[model samples]
Target: METAMSDIKIIMKETYSKLVTFKRKENRESFNKELLKVLPQIYRYVSKRLNSAVANGKLNKGMFNPSDFTDQLFIEVYDNIDDIKSENELHVFLFKKVDELLEDSLVEEEFDHVFFDNIDTYSKPEWDAMEENYTQDGDGDFLLLEELDDSSLDKTNYTLNHVFITDEEKKLADKLDASLDKERIYNHIQLVLDKMNLPMRTVFELFTNEGLTTEEIADIRKTTLDQVEELLASARLLLKNSFEKRFLIDSN
Candidate 1:
């Protein structure tokens, strides 16, 4: 995640260029090479999500093996990767597909493997909720909220400084020590973000999570820097206020 946005962009551009420059066989080979290079990062990212999902009770442990399932996903992603325009796009698409597929596969595979053992005790509502969570036509209720484009900007688009992540925010994030509950804070923050409209949420993810610069976010979302700044500022304001309220100012 610490990889700079410019470096990511350069890698994307170079890989795309390589794919288009070669003959049929060479291009396929080149694409495979690029995919191989990124596989470690992808696996680590996917493993983290799978672990989180299992922790959240969204996935059963004995249902489907994650490594094998990830291999299957990599194959599917490889087949579909040609349509992706950039590395970021590929990453976003991969995770979106993973989120959707993980639920279905876990449910269906568990049904297959545990048909006799848990046939009478199957929890349908949990499966239903998990399926509904990723539906494209549903209310945009993303559990991970990684892939999406945002065009809306707040009405009051203030032109703040290009630099974001103020010292206060950094200090708060870093102050996750023995006293504070870091997990609960982030989980609440994500809950708040999930309810937000697309533009602000998307900007927040790119700016804060992906370490993208304001200019990079603006260009990717095809908006002006001021608009991105406003969206990001709005997200920060909401988060900052929410955290302060939750943590309670300890004036000793």
Candidate 2:
């Protein structure tokens, strides 16, 4: 019987300790002090309520675990302890729990607000210097930071500060620069002019006073209509030959 009583005492102490420790990771010294104050209050409240059960041998220490105590507390004061059939009883019940939460002596110090303030306040000059160092690139222009011009859809309207050579133009230019012969180049230019078929413009440039037509050329050359047609055909062929010699004969 003595052994049973001792075991019951141990169970009460262990269960109460577990409730105070459960899910609490704050200051150990403060928590233990607060818990010490809470345990006696809980013991008194439970003991008074279960006096009949204890006498009847129904209320055992092993059955009253930390979870069981928490459950009982929840049921007791859940919808206002005043509704628990007695005013003085509910007052004493809640007063002890509230006292445990608000015990000023148990808390040795307030939260470190100065440490938080120091973290919030930073040196602006130091930040500015660091930003300058971070952004420093020895290059003349920061291409990445260039703003896109949204004003025009025409690609030619945009000017590249650096010489821009397209892949196709670059390749063709490179090949021509390496291999093109002088005669071939000259012929190609003449061929292009011939293809333009602007005899009136040429006549205006060469002899400002004299006006000439295709018929006049035929008469001067002493050719029939059919012969004139053949001569024009031959002229076209000669122009094509000249163009091929000048331009089509590609120089490296």
Residue 91 C-alpha lDDT in model 2:
29
Q: Could you say which candidate leads in TM-score?
A: 1
Over 118-137, each residue of candidate 2 has an lDDT whose tens digit, in order, gives 42232434433422432231
lDDT of prediction 1: 0.48
Tens-digit per-residue lDDT, 99-200, candidate 1:
455545542211122322332343445323433452322222222212211211111111111122576556665654334454444444544454444567
What stretches of model 2 exceed 4 Å from their correct place?
1-211
TM-score of 2: 0.18
Weakest lDDT window of 10 consecutive positions for candidate 1: 151-160
